[model samples]
Target: MYQKKVKESNKNNIFKYIFEKRKSFVINDIAENLNITFPTVKKIINSFLKQNIIFERQKVGFGVGRKAMEYELNEEFCYSIGILASSTKLKFILTNAIGKILKQQIYELKSNNCKAEILNSTKDFLNTISPEVRKKLIGIGISVPGIVSEEGNFIEFSSKEKIVLSFIEELKNLFHIPVLIENESNLAAIAEAFLTRNSIYSTFTILTINEYVGISNFHQDSLNNTLFFKAGRLHHMVIESNGKLCECGTHGCWGTYVSDKVLLNDFQKYFPSIKTYNEIFDLKYHETNIGASLIDNYLEHLAIGIKNILFFSNPEKLIISGNISIYKEYIADKLIEKIYKNHIFYRGKETIVFSSLNENGSIIGAAMFPILDKII
Candidate 1:
């Protein structure tokens, strides 16, 4: 019995390895990469083929030897829905087994009518998906900003209550599949780790700067237990003892200085017509004085926040995501330069990077949970 269980576990690991690669692999490639015997790898591949969990693709020529058959995940074999609930919008995405997004829909949300809007939008999205895709849906994953209970049954959002018990219950009844909910920042970090295959860093910190600021730490491809909920509440962290007031009723919080809203407010004063962070970034490239000044100050405050994070966590890599990452080249370079210039402790060691997943990291990460939960 123990041997049987071990074999089953190995099979599952092989299956998961293929999905994570997100590409075709031959029997020898799988065996060598996963450190399994060729015979065992072949057996697992055949079983997966028979189960319709994976399928063969065109053969790839290997030097003078006969072509080797490549196998890839049968993406349509299963699907997942990911919903990102923000203060202003609800973004829904459908992803296949390999985490490729098949379809996406967004609906504007109202503070007062959030519950009704979400239910209606979700139903509309469900109706629009192809029947074939819906039939294969394994589960739904919801990503909400702010803290989620460890059990994922409760939420503590900074904005209005977008994801409540009633909403969760309604979704479960409607879908009748496993539903996973997680904090947006945590999901973003997970997405970064999974999508990059840990190429970025096995352990790092992700800072999301949008309407609100969010921070989460990932260690060895997983969330660090020490940074959960209250500990990871970076937005409320006091950067200034007597600084500007924050919506959280705190003075000198990090969010007040670096969030998109704050940046926009400062930008609007100089160029009232300029709308969107993208435009500001574009203007900066033109050497506009106002644009340069705004970005300089933004980078300075951001550097301060990052320095504080380093003081505590000292993460080897820092990933900046959300609205700011859209200007990855500009923001990352400036932030890195500022950190190196200002902070003596992290002058040359730490690596600062941008989220390769961009804005979709949270939604994609959330969508992957349903499939990941079963595999991992």
Candidate 2:
């Protein structure tokens, strides 16, 4: 038993080192970095190659007569499927072990509360992937807006299996592998942090604005979701305490000011024909557009919530995600000026910017969860 545990530990540590490096490594490099025995590293590499988890990328000379084989994760074999289940949309993202997206698609949800419909749609979506790719699927990752346990289910919200447990099991049966789920905000934080794996700020906070507002703080090396209602509650933070009414029957929630509903409701007034963020923001011009006209008020409300978040969490960095990022070109500097100006509680050294991954952050992070499980 002791020998078996040691071997497994050595194998995991070595694999994790290689995975985090995100580069090709020789057996010596793996052994040296992880302090594993040369023989143990060789044995594990053989197992990984046979399992098709890693492959020999090439041979590198180490100043010796013979060159050593370079090994790296086989991106083709270590793939994942991500599903984002939300109120109005069921989005799917396919990605490799390192979160490089292969393909993604979105479909409107006929009924958000219907579990059977969601599962059926998922089966149909998976069937769309090529048979060859399916054979290589390592696992399926799920992202939901509700708060969930680390085991990745919405049980905490309702504490009932009916809501999402069976759905996770069906996915496990589908791939014969792990099916992990988590709060979409946590996953978004993971995706954003991973993208900046080499960056200076490892501890940070990220805010996403869409149909609602999601706020997540990521400390270095942490992927755990730690909020009561998390971003959902951020929507109801009551910046104004007695302002605009919310769909949840509340007033002055930060979401009431900046959510898609805010713009959607206003846009419908002018261009009743159009109904999505894309249509509104992608118009030929926003200079005289309703969407454009709503900017100042939107930014003011947005900055207030942002200032509150920074003052409380005080993360190393703050990022804007979701459709809100689409306006980065127009709002980045303007938004920054508003947040920093006349702020007494906020101390500087907090970096604020927009995510390049923006809209795709949740799905990409969801798919990468299964990949991250390999090392975790």
Candidate 3:
């Protein structure tokens, strides 16, 4: 019985490995890459076919022994729902196992009313979607703007608002499927890693500077999700001995120096005419040194944040994200330059990279949970 179970597990791993490499794969190539006997690979592929987890298509290569049989994940096999609850908005997306969006819903709400707003928004979102898609969904992934529990519960908020944990349980019970909840920063990092599967740099950290500064890390082995989330709640890292007071009563938390609130406050003081971040971007074209200085000063504190992670996790790369990052070009290089200048010995050379996933990284990360669920 144990041996039978082991065989089954091995097949599952092979399937997962192929699915992760890309959206599709060929039989001979999968066997070679997974280092499994050709017969075993064929058997596993047949099993996946029986389960409707994968399907095969004939492709004529430039030159091949026979028409190659290309195996790809069945797009209709399952679905995953992603909820990105941000400080200013709650965006919901329903996607297939491949992270392709089938539908999306967005709602604007006050940050202070997060708990109630999130619950209402989710309920309404489900109601608005087609029943057929909802029924096929294997799981729901919630990416909250605040800290989340290891058990997939939203526990705390970024600002004064609190994240209601009960909604998670409610969704699980209502949908009758697994529900995974995580911090939005963690979701962004996961999405970033998914897009850069070709890079040798396995460990990565992503910081999103939106209405709040959010952080998360990913290790090479893909087990970094939970571990990094536990370590990156930098509400109080104590980077400066005599710095500005933080909301958490710390002398110099990273958030104190580099949060959206601080930047907007400075903008209001200096560029009082500017009403919104979008307006500033449109009007200034980000040419004003004053705004650049605000970003530079924030980057200084951000460098300290990266330094702490470098000493601790030693990630191979760092990615700067969020709404601001999408608009601000050359931000990643400037951040790395600041870190190298301040550090005693520069170790993170060419390790920092800009995020390619853009603002949708978090949502895509949320979409990955369903693919993972189907495999497990």
Estimate the overall C-alpha local distance difference test score of candidate 2: 0.70
lDDT of 1 at 239: 84
lDDT of 3 by residue, 327-368 (tens): 546466787777787566445466666666667777877877
**Model 3: runs farther than 4 Å from truth?**
1-8, 50-52, 61-66, 110-115, 150-154, 159-167, 198-200, 220-229, 240-242, 283-285, 373-376
lDDT of each: 0.75, 0.70, 0.69
Find the number of clashing residue pairs for candidate 1. Answer: 0
- lDDT winner: 1
Model 3 / residue 213 / CA error / Å: 2.7
Which of 1 and 3 is ahead in TM-score?
1
lDDT of 3: 0.69
lDDT of 2 by residue, 15-112 (tens): 65766675678899988887888998999899989988788865855575767788877767667888886677778888877788888888787754
Q: Candidate 2: where are CA atoms >4 Å away?
A: 1-8, 57-64, 149-167, 170-177, 198-202, 220-232, 271-275, 289-291
lDDT of 3 at 157: 59
TM-score of each: 0.86, 0.83, 0.81
Best by TM-score: 1
Model 2 lDDT-worst window of ten: 221-230
| lDDT value for model 1 | 0.75
